[model samples]
Target: MKDLSDKALFALVQDHDERAFAVLLERHSGLVYDLVYKRTRDDDDTKDILQDIFISLWNNREKIRIEESIYPYLHRSAKYAVIDLAIKNQRVTAYQSLLAKQDEPFCHPAETGLIASELQQQYEQEVARMPGTMQQIFRLSRDQQLSAREIALQLQISEQTVRNNITLALKKLRLSLGSDQLIVLLPLSLYISSALAVN
Candidate 1:
């Protein structure tokens, strides 16, 4: 098992051989960690993304085809994981920044800082009302700045499920926040619309 090639281990992994999967994870973890850490520069985020990659590998093992070393696949996956984290973090930062500035003077009365503060409270209330799992997913995305893959790995769910919950959560927020809130929030309204459209 220790000496098996990536292809060989992956073949066993497809067959549900836990030992083979463990071997593959052990053999390639350092490489993935190095790649992820270089891009992310945060140890915790690096480990989280590393877990996401292998969990992704194990989850998708049946569909994954490897002709040689899994190094290439792992490398590509690491890059994607970093990109995923960055995108999620960017979205979180943008929205949080908007929230943070809610008290700053903006435009009219309803669109004023007071209204923005009220909107922030209202948004939190809406988030609190979300279904337990969806709320957890949303918080992980917004507060912890974790990607869908990272959230899924942490929650032991599929990435698609994580994405779906996030989409639904955002939709709920849009509806609850209303167009008036959007008008007051400036950029977040635009971000929300674009995010929903893009997702």
Candidate 2:
């Protein structure tokens, strides 16, 4: 197994051969870890993302094609996994900034209620217009206060899928409600982003 080519190992993996999978991991994990660590910098995040990459590889092994080499496939997967971590981290920072700004006075009590109500209505309308899956994902993350991991587990999907759906939902809501309304929704967004970050 150790002497087998990547294509051969992958073929065995596709056949559910655990020894082949182990050989492939032994051969490629160092490179995958290095690629992911370079992008992440944080040891903890790198470890988590590296594990995710392998889990993803195993989950989608049947669909993977190995015409020439497996290096490109592993490289691309590592890159994307790191990118997803980066995006999630950026959202956490943004959410923290927005949370800090929440301390400053923005409006009078009466105006605050009116603005929040209007924003809530617009948010609901925009969500209603989303695809059913997107709406469910958004609600799970936002309204139900579930972490991306939690939502992913509940829905039996990848965390990336949950994040993508939430991102799309936010984009659609922003486009429909305008950037100005984002302020009113900041608290909710912050909550969701923070939840995702922690998990």
lDDT of each: 0.74, 0.73
Question: Residue 178 CA error for candidate 2 (Å)?
Answer: 25
Tens digits of per-residue lDDT for model 2, 1-199: 6888989889998996656776777678788778888877887666656655665676688998887568898898888877777786798799778867886655779987887798788788878989999999988877777887789889999866886687677778778886447645744433322333431
Candidate 2 at residue 139, lDDT?
85
Writing each residue's lDDT as its tens digit, candidate 1 over 38-124 gives: 889998778767755776686688999988999899999988889988997898799878877888644677666676687788888
Among the numbered candidates, top TM-score falls to 1
Cα lDDT over the full model 2:
0.73
Overall local distance difference test of candidate 1 = 0.74
